[model samples]
Target: MGTKIGVIGGSGVYEIDGLQDAAWVDIDSPFGAPSDQILTGRLGGVEMAFLPRHGRGHVHSPSTVPYRANIDALKRLGVTDVISVSACGSFREEMAPGDFVIVDQFIDRTFAREKSFFGTGLVAHVSVAHPTCPRLSQACLEAARAEGIKVHDGGTYLAMEGPQFSSMAESKLYRDAWGCDVIGMTNMPEAKLAREAELCYASVAMITDYDSWHPDHGAVDISDIIATLTGNADKARALVARLPALLGPERAPCPHGCDRALEHAILTAPEKRDPAMIEKLSAVAGRVLG
Candidate 1:
């Protein structure tokens, strides 16, 4: 197998075509079962792992997806690069429906989730000031462009706690005051957890609606969002199809420092480190300990 690239498909992106030798692999992480059984296969001669964030039938809610379990499963599968494909509402006028954005920054507004792996017996704080791996983001942008999709190079994604769409006031605040490019649910703890797992993370934001900020559009419509999500899902698949080609057959260390995020993050003294915690973290932090 080649370098493992993990792809987490968001709403409406439950399947990826053209993966040869595909087989469903049920992964058990210390956190719990992943959103769904991981699909492992090869694309363009490169090994890839696909996991549907919302489960196969879109059963999980935004707040319910096991973010920690998902990341841990990817890590256990030896995933070096993770690409999160998410449907988002545009916060900017230029980022219209059907457009794609490679999110480079994030403002996490998630309220209910365990966003870290180092706590309790272990104490570690990884810097998330610059979260997304630039190299990976660049590759995703290039892949989208090469696939003939309209792609924005960089943007800040505001991850809100929601199965519900943002209110007009909240949407306007995020757009006008905070200056976010996109808004979505589910990217929070996912992004944070990816860092803790030492995986190079990149998100491809598929614009599905205009939230409630656009005067021309009424309050975010679930029906319209769902319709747009279908189209965006197709685009997401096209973009993913070109990823292996863009990334090439070999793997390179992340130029943006994403792969070594936990280098100095483990603060517990070696003798004081909890054996159980170390055992649990070994799957993700073995290199750091070694």
Candidate 2:
């Protein structure tokens, strides 16, 4: 596969200073319409696809962001790698607001969303023990650092089910007991589905506030987070520009096997698999479904 980079991020991250030939192109997926038209362009001579995670004006909430459609669309766009950038609340003081964390792990507490492309008719289990692609993440980390963004190379992200912010008790538990470094409302089904789609995935969590756990910072509030996102947005855009230069215009197979997750994961016999489900899996599991 070529080094076509797909970035699923908020509206502001896509408009870097020197993006060439940028255009938002619509993609209708079997899963559904993606969050918005994907902004397709070239940066650093690499093909880039940028989808606004929350739609153009930030319409969708966390649970309803159409995670499946977004990943499926990116896969269909011929994106060899997917990078997710989302606003998060910090659990650790050191991480702080405005820091960018290259999330290495996830504890997905989101239960209401469709977490995979395969289901009852077509079953598959892909390993997510080490979810994020290390090589891709290193590129992201390097990109952020080169832009003078405060980048933490690794951290554990706790993905919560929410349109609601975490309660104080929940925040404390995630911070003190679970050892979560940052908390976000998205990145759950998003990351999991990417693995099932066999796309190299990397998550960069931009801290917007301290989630209810900091006594000094107090509880995480949407207003503060929004204000923080203004700066985060600028930092994120700068970070995005640096990626294409670092990742280059061609790529090697993911050293971690993210590009071929379904080689042996599908346990359902081909004869037993539903034709309808197989048709829907054309873009995602095509390499194996054939």
Candidate 3:
């Protein structure tokens, strides 16, 4: 068997092609139901699980994506690595529509979501300063290059809390003051939770617009974004299909230390650790306790 990989689809990417024996599996997590049922199958002979970030019919808003459940569900399904494909607006002049960015850093402006797994009874604080796995990022970069796609190796992504697009003032601030490369609504709590679960995480950002900050472009529009996203979706699928071959047949430890983040993070004394919380986190933090 090959290493298990999980792909989180965003925006226009609802499904992946070339997945053999694809079957939808609804997994119940301690957090709750994931955005939707996960589809499991083989891609390039590797075991792959795909979860639509916005739900099957695109029902959930960015703020309502059930991120905790999505991460937990992927963990429960034995997902060792996760590739999040998100649609974003460019903050830089060079990152235009139809291009791909492998984000290495993030600036989270989101507030209303549950961003951690250690709550209630269990309390574990995992390090997230460097979020995405460098190993996986390298693989994604190589895959993108091999596919002849316009790709940027690394950049900072700004994650905002939004059912609404950012205002012109806000967009300008993020682009100028924040020095971010791209902006999007989701990818925060999901990336943080994946770290807490010790799962490798990386994001493939597909630029759809220049946001509201670009002087030459008009204000951010949903209709225009959708059209650009539809075209990028096909490219995203092609990039994913090439990842397994680039990553190889077996798994290797993350060079960036993403998988070992919780090594000493649990602050609660062994005797003080909440039994109820421990039970709830059994699936995710069991190795730490063991």
Candidate 4:
């Protein structure tokens, strides 16, 4: 009934100040287990949910992240807006480590994951023409600025399938050829799935390296990234604290129609639709399918 904010990031966001009545709730998802138990609470006079993208102790790899389950779990818990905070490698010279980028677009090169909720018995297609919610992105940009973090208002994120960092050639191609602002292993299917779930979504990419393209910096090192994450995580927490106040405690139909994504997207006729599949979608597409 009210504006429910879902923050998906690292474990640090759970410690954000001003959260009241925090509790870790395990939710059952039609897709499967989410990355971890969702931490639910109230912040800035609005309901809030924080999910650790990689699960506690950093168990899941990039390709292995349960993107569908994560999105569905948030939707099941009544989260209306989703904000994904990811650690990324910067392509631009000025977007250095510790900086944040409010990502507007994505170039997905990931091939080894289920990128959608509709398939087989339940067929559907949703436009990702503009992958993220612009209104939500603006709020994130303001939040990061208010936290005193260096945040770029717009960026294009290149999503790669990886547990491996990019090679110099691949990195250069993304920066110089494809013109990507940041590169990360996640965010492709995650963003796509959010659109399908009809949730307003935004992304905040935390720059942690120059990738392998910068002549001055060699290949990326996990140790350096780990150190940078310690700082970025703090800024992420500060940014999260600013969200609820800006978004408020009431809901509005997304001006961009993100909430109505399924209005004409589902292809399967009601009579021909699979009862099992439709039942599975009861929560995700109840507004349109039922």
Clashes of each: 0, 0, 0, 0
Clash number for model 1?
0
lDDT computed for candidate 4: 0.91
RMSD (Cα, Å) of model 1: 1.1
Best by lDDT: 4
Clashing pairs in 3: none
Question: Tens digit of lDDT per residue, candidate 1, span 165-242?
Answer: 999999999999998999999889898889988899999999998999999998988889899999899889988988
Q: How much is 104 displaced in model 3, in angstroms?
A: 0.6
lDDT of each: 0.90, 0.89, 0.89, 0.91
TM-score of 1: 0.98
RMSD of each: 1.1, 1.2, 1.2, 1.1
lDDT of 1: 0.90
| Candidate 1 clash pair list | none
Error of 1 at 268 (Å): 1.0
Question: In terms of TM-score, how similar is model 2 to the real structure?
Answer: 0.97
Among residues 3 or more apart in sequence or in different chains, the pairs in candidate 4 whose N, CA or C atoms overlap within 3 Å are: none
lDDT of 2 by residue, 1-290 (tens): 46999988863454446658978788879999988898888988999998888888889989899999999999999999898989998999899888999999999998899898988989999999999999999999988988889889899999999888899999999999999999998899888999999999999999999999899988777788888888998888888888888889989888899999999999898889999999999999988888
Per-residue alpha-carbon lDDT of model 4 for 145-238, expressed as tens digits?
8888999989999999998989899999999999999999989899999999999999999998899999898899988988999899989988
